[model samples]
Target chain A: MINTEPSRTRLPAVLATAKNSDGARDEPGEEIPQTISPIRTFLMGRSSGAGVDLLFYGVMVLCAVSIFVIVLAIIFVLFQNSALSRHQFGFTFFKGQDWDPVSGLFGAWPFIVGTLLSSLIALVIAVPLALGVAIFVTELCPKFLQGPISFLTELLAAIPSVVYGLWGIFVLVPLVRDHVGPFLLKYLGWTGLFGGLNIGVGLLTAGIILAIMILPVISSLTRDVMRAVPTSQREAVLALGATRWEMIRTGVLRNARIGIVGSIILGLGRALGETMAVTMLIGNRAEVPHSLFSPAHTLASVIANEFSEATGDLYLSSLIEIGLALFAVTIVVNAIARLLIWAVTRGAPARVA
Target chain B: MAIEPAGVSLPDNTPGPVPASEPKSTGPGRNRNVLRSVIDHSVTGLSILATVVVLAPLVAILGYLLFKGFSSLNFAFFTQAPRPVGEAGGGMANAIVGSGIVLAIASAIGIPVGIGAGVYLAEYGRNGVFANFVRFTADVLNGVPSIVMGIAAYSLIVVRQHHFSAMAGGIALAIMMVPTITRTTEEMLATVPGAVREAALGLGIPKWRTTISVALRTASPGIITGCMLAFSRVAGETAPLLFTAFGNQFWSVKLGQPIAALPLQIYIYAVSPYDEWHRLAWAGALVLIVLIMASVTLVRIFAGRGVLKGNS
Candidate 1:
């Protein structure tokens, strides 16, 4: 049918062509031409091209989606575990002070206390030292000594926390237990906190270890902040007949206060979340102790010590809940720090403008 | 407050002459200067003391570690596997190899994803909500205790498979590595000049292509340094590996099986009561320290070169 239709349609074209040829006079050497089909070009153009733009946008969307997907996955897995969710929902999980896994009871109070106490101790030890290091490097130290001293201070950060744990276990703990603890007990034994029998692995040891771990962080951040203070400010203070120390205190430190606070907060965050070193030195006992010398547990150390053996639904859930608490704490700490830093540095730039 | 424009030197002690009309009183400025000197010296001394206090333990520990660990570092310690606790003539070959494999896997998985995210944040998403989200997430992840990551990895990867394996350990290490690399990569990419990006885009190149080819290339040295920092961090992590990889007894190359890492081995040996194990622990520590120091040195060199090139 299709062949017949094409032949039937060609009859009119043939007649028209014959008529045209009869009327027209052709040049002797002229060649007759065949017409190229127009429809074919449109079909080729349509067939050859693909949706390149669609593909590009598709990939970009995919790339962006993956990040959200990963975050969702974390939330899902954490929440999906019934063991973790059930225990976390209860008010007692956070409020209750006791945390004994053997009886299937869990409370985060002691761990929270330990985390706070250790971090606070670390801050007390590290802040002044870090400030000193920053000041010395930026203001006090001779030019030749500056590089080596700064390098030495930063080297502390390079050493792993676990190595610190190992050192604490072998060297620090022994020194503390044998000599330092004994001496402190003898001298300050009247204080209830220091009166306890020394086991060596307690708040003091953990704090000291944490101080060592966090010093470099504080020192490095403070040094950077101090360096950011304007040279003109330093000069102005010095020109005002202020001594070098006064210049640094009023000009450099006052200007960098927010940055310093940020550094300290960062250090505190590190102290709070530190795991292995605290796990090793904290003695991993669950009970809250009034005495600094008594062994304790932090949220991080608790998770590290027990998560492996945690088989029960409540036990596993409690651990996850502890993690959630840690997450919340860190977010809050970082947010506050960022805000504080913004406030401090924000004024300086505006004044400059 | 303005200084004289012409060539002139200001005297150190003289106050700018207050207008002569102001009443001149007793020269309390001199006494003030004396008080200032006292405060200055005290601050300087106090600051010096504080620096010394923070530094003392580091020096002491390094000195002690070298004194103790170096003595135990003989050829035998590196050539052989760890012996029985009381037995002698063993090294940390198995632990060393295991650590190497884990770190390699971690670097491979972490570097690309981290650098890509960083590029996105710095180039396309600067000041955008997504960038803010990523930044916050990265900070939180970095602050997430390594032990928690280990637990999470254990629950998700290790326990699901019902086995402890090196891959699981690698996954845990990668989790730790990601935040570090992300942070470092973002910082490094930020260090690259906006002019470079503008120049590339001005040529009509696609934004993504320009970012990958131009911006990333310029920031490569800093990125590498960041990677090294991340590597050094995970290399020494023991808690995560403890739960995910668990420790192996003999030398084994199987990724699906439990493997011994240097840090875990050190943890075990250091805590163990045996004298031989203690010696081996010290040896393992020394090796880890050397490896870390070497990587750090390499990173500093690369970063320094990048800075020098930028200056030139």
Candidate 2:
């Protein structure tokens, strides 16, 4: 079947060449008899060049639609394999706290809560910093410094997540446990959120590392959005005798607010699904955290940490279900994000800048 | 002093010219303006500080990894499997070779199909309903967590085969690569001038031939870089391989057999309780970082030269 796809497209080109050969036979001194069969020539005549191109075009459309097929396959496999948990636990599977694999009890509540809380914390920490970086790079920094600084910021995204995990283990965890955690506990101890034992590796550490991991994505994307704002807007605001900040506030940022929000949501999507660094730093505890310093396990982290050790069919299915939930969350979040971005730039010329 | 108009307040300071204020009369208002300016300047300063603070980790990770891991990266580290537990001085040869093999298989699966889909998007299905669906699916696929992909691969390949294998691992990696390569290839192909297509079509060339031979050739460099970036990304992904490749202690090259990879080895070593393994993990990390950085740098160099023409 695959071989025929190419040959079908090739036949038209061959027929065109054969027609050219016939045309050559019509010229003076060209006495060669056409070797082409009449039936074959008739068939070729019936299928115009446009029809052959249309055939290939249809083939290419199938190729494009196959990408959608792959995505559906991913969703299908995840849902199909997790059927045991879906049947056994039902709705309670999402809400139950018990997750013992030995006794066959499984609950996704803690993992779900942990994933949300960590991603929330990551966004809280990342959004302000990323906005600042974007603002500075777009509106404040000297032209000479802008390119290098933006490049440096984006370099963070290129570093593998495992390397981030390594750095978290060696550098960030200790810094959090020794200093930042204790300080937050000491000062914000009145609030229950910060009132916990300051283990270096916990929800906060994971969240902070997630923030750092996603900083480049948010900042770069925001910069792209902010840069997309027409310069005329900035100049108009400035012409009204506004300060640089005021011009940026009233012009560039306001114009790009939807896109900026989309970028932040996109960052949130990434944080929700980040695995290696969060797994390494979150201490791999399957409990709902009482406070920022308490250890927790996100869905992605839990799956990464325990997929290999899960021996039973139910155990494996439960993990697959967690993956399904994670897949569902990220898909929903990213879809919304893309739509928000599309609203701002729809029908605009698609260009990298 | 000149009497002010009744109920008139002072005009707010603006960069444009304003009526001159009596110094003695507007002293308090002047103080408020000064404070506002001070706050604004400091806010800018803080934003700059925030940029620096966020950027520090990239430098720290690179510098620290180079400092800590560079020492352990000798000849032996590249040519041997990880030492068993406590006794020191081994390498990650199997994992390195396994990574190469897995990535090779992944590229083989991902590149042609991804570029074909991209060609469809750019050439045939531009703005069509099915094209939009494919584009959206690619976006969602890119955002799908690697661990979830691992789970999907586990269900799809491992369960059917009744065991983990390199083929499953490659499929997971290929799945991860597909969206990125497809999107970037579409972007690259979109950058190819329309005139090129018209030129090819005016010659009575089939649209498929024009897309494949003419347009694809023009966009090939960017697409190559996109595939490279995708390869570099999956090369360091550990989560998808956790259940798929499943790791090996010694050498294994069969496609159906389980294998080890650099990221998987690094994950195992980093999490293991032994100090020597941690040291080896550091070395492996340095090597992995180098591999990723090399590709990224190559992309950047190509990007700077306008080879991708900013379509990346």
Leading candidate by lDDT: 2
Off by over 4 Å in 1: A1-68, A82-85, A342-353, B1-36, B194-209, B303-312
Second chain only: TM-score per model?
0.86, 0.88
Report the C-alpha lDDT of model 2 over B211-280, residue by residue, as the tens digit. 8888887887788889888988898898899899999988999999999999998988888888888888
Model 1 clash pairs?
A84-A317, B80-B91
**Residue-wise C-alpha lDDT for candidate 2, range A1-353, written one tens digit per residue:** 99799667556555554667444333344333345645356545653468878887777677677778888888898888899989999989999998888899999999998999999999999999999999888777766688899889887887888888988998998999889888887888888898667779899999999999889889998887876666566667666656566767888789989999999999999999999989999988888788888898999998988888898889988888899988999999999888887776664334212
lDDT at position B203, candidate 2: 58
lDDT of 1 by residue, B1-312 (tens): 122111012222324332232345448855555565577668778988887887788898788778878998898877788776667778899999999988887888777667666766766667888778877777666766777677777778886899999999997887678777777777888988899989866755556666667777788888888888889988889988978888887998789999989999888787778888887888788889889999889889988898777555
* lDDT of candidate 2 at residue B102, scale 0 to 100: 91
Native-referenced TM-scores of chain A, all candidate models: 0.78, 0.82
In angstroms, the error of model 2 at B250 is 0.6
Residue pairs in clash, model 2: none
